[model samples]
Target: MQAFEAFMDDLERVIRSAGDSGRGVLVGGDFNTRSPTWDPAVSNRRGELLERWAASCGVSLHNDGCTATCVRAQGSSVVDLTWSTPSLTPTVQQWRVLTERETLSDHLYITYEIRGPRRVKSGDGGGHARWNWRKFNAECFRESLDTCLAWGPTGEDQTTLAGLAAWVERTMTQACDAAAPRARTKSSNQEPRRLTRDRRAASGPHHDIEAEYRASKRRLRDSIKAAKAKAWEDLVGSVESNPWGIPYKLVLGRLRTASRGLTENLDSETLGRLLTALFPRGEGSVPVSQEDRSWNEG
Candidate 1:
């Protein structure tokens, strides 16, 4: 216990450094601690200490009410856990257990998705140029480009071909500069992308709906969070005293899913790859086979 406290103190030091630096934090693994906040089935001394540590650090536990992280003949345990700071909680769009995939360990696989600013493309950011087309005066631009096209020098034979080429390029570039092209998105002073969409697209009479829409969306997310916690609690209660109930529920879930259409509209190449296991590869085709199709299946 003394050694565990030392280790926890060291870990907290790193977490504190991350918070002070304003860097997002994500720490996840088999914690081997059980808490009512995360699993609801049980709570232990170490789990209580862990909660206190997180609260002191202003980090949120993300594995709330998640169960069956480790399953055995006797029962399932929510030993696997994930933790993130306040700066990171909003960025985690989804977090759940991967029940479809089973490992040699009693522990199940877990996954979480982070939704935030994508890294800027490296190596000169090669893509089509973006201009302030929304505010552009198209008529004036057309006249300017047309004048550039008409005014090329037929009399520049006095200069070298290279000089004439440079002159034309300079003229066109100046015109384009005057046209006010931009390379990045316009910054918004308030609200988010979705809220901005709601506000901007609102008509005069329907403007009141914008605020209501925002509130409704917030409520929906909160409701989902609460409902998931309750659902997991119910599941744990049902299976706690009956180990056989776990497999029964698993079989029923499989049956329900099997009744639904499993195949989606797939492009030819993707469809071929998806069906490769059931269908032999055609002659001359590259022998590429994916044993684990769980990449996007979840």
Candidate 2:
């Protein structure tokens, strides 16, 4: 019992750490224990403790109360339980207890939808996502950068590394904002197209943003279905045309999902390089860095 108590303490710490990134968490296993929330066959001390632990942490119990997670010759018990954080609880579309299984253990198979982070489109009410890298104007960006970098950090501002970093970030952000401002995603204020256009739009999508972003996987479902059908068609066409060249592999490929239109995931070294790229000093200006020469290039 002492060992079990220690395990529960460690479990809480782990769950807290997992939720530190502001994302939902899922912690589950055959907890050789029983609680009133999940268990039905019997009651025990360990199960009660687990219930309290879950309640204190604000986690949601996923057991349907009557669904038994285990079966034995003498009797069955709901030992295998699942616990989810509030953020992830609603995303659980379904929970099931599989009865038929070829296993020695009494514990039945438990299934639930543990959703991942739902990344939205560029202009869905919030993210500054209209960054068209394909159509980026290099010359315009260069001129904007130069204009911003001309007013470099003064001698007083260059006293500390932190100050220099702040100055560089401000300069780069200003330049980017001025030169290539991100396009806004409009909802419905545009001029109406013909009925044909409306029909085409209906075949694809209409809503820019969803109310419940977590469980709203309608977009993902439709997209995968469409891709699968297109891939099938491409394979058929390729077979009909050549039968040797697989056009499905070459032509029927989708572009990678883009970033959130910002340089976010950067280490200390990479961050230094990015700053240097934004502000490479001229002859009269203070040197950015000797190691970041590649970034300092035109």
Candidate 3:
């Protein structure tokens, strides 16, 4: 309709003004248009026109595939869309619909964050350990723990509850450290986490035959490596084509994340103390009797 076109034109003007001022632009709402680009359903004339308008305005579509943004008694479709200027696209992380949020409308709630440079926390330079669950030896862990427990009540630790708890905690920590593998520093050249997880799953003991699992694992690894190499090549090509563009901005983001380092891990003693402080013991509190439950009867 003429009215819809006029409204779209006004939105384009606002987006252009923001981009021209060197500020980020994020426009998101019910577009009332359907396209296969953002959903599995068929396309419409309005969606095509909107796509053209976005291209001309230098805005990128941030909606991920096949998620139903609008649901009704009839069915579901992805009518709602999120658009961001090219400068803001790389910074937009986790652009997805919050289906659990009750909006009391047909359209689902969408959320995203424009991430900034991460600030490095103190004591995070020396990386902390995290259990590599994929390589954990459960049998080994059990044996180690049993051995430690068998040698119980050693020294004055048995005299006090705190000392006994500390001793037990130390024993468990020792067993876990011995039996579990630690995750290493992640490289910038590492493949995507999703792909890595898929590869791990393929290599797991789910296949009927060992050879089938091995073949699947090989294929997944090869595919992931090829995809990573191709993506890097494309990024390089883009940088070469446009010296100051989205590719450059994305590279800057990667550099910032690489320098931020991993988060520090809290020890069990500190975690326990924090939990205890947050949920203190109610020594003198009285328990409510069942006879006082008059609200349930009503």
| Candidate 1 structure quality by residue, lDDT tens digits, 1-298 | 6676777788888876764453667888887887888877899888888887766665656675865788999999888888876445545657888888968878888888986523323432353334556766666455445544433333342156975685565445434443545446433223477787886787565777777898999999999999999988887787758856764667576434534454655677887887886776677576757885558666
Q: How far off is residue 132 in model 2, in Å? A: 31
Where model 3 places Cα greater than 4 Å from the true spot, the runs are 118-298
lDDT of 3 by residue, 1-298 (tens): 7787888899988876664454667888888887778877888888888877876676667788788899999999998888776445545778888988999998889888886423223344344435667888888677556544443434445677987786776556556565665455453225577788887888756644788878999999999999999998988888778977778777576434434443236677887888788777786545667886767555
Which number leads on lDDT? 3
> Which one is best on TM-score?
2
lDDT of 2 by residue, 81-172 (tens): 78776545545647888877656777778877754334336457565434445656777557545533433454434577886786676455
lDDT on C-alpha atoms for all candidate structures: 0.66, 0.65, 0.71
Provide the global lDDT of candidate 1 against the true structure.
0.66
Better of 1 and 3 by lDDT: 3
TM-score per candidate, chains pooled:
0.40, 0.42, 0.40
lDDT of 2: 0.65
- Candidates 1 and 2: which is better by lDDT? 1
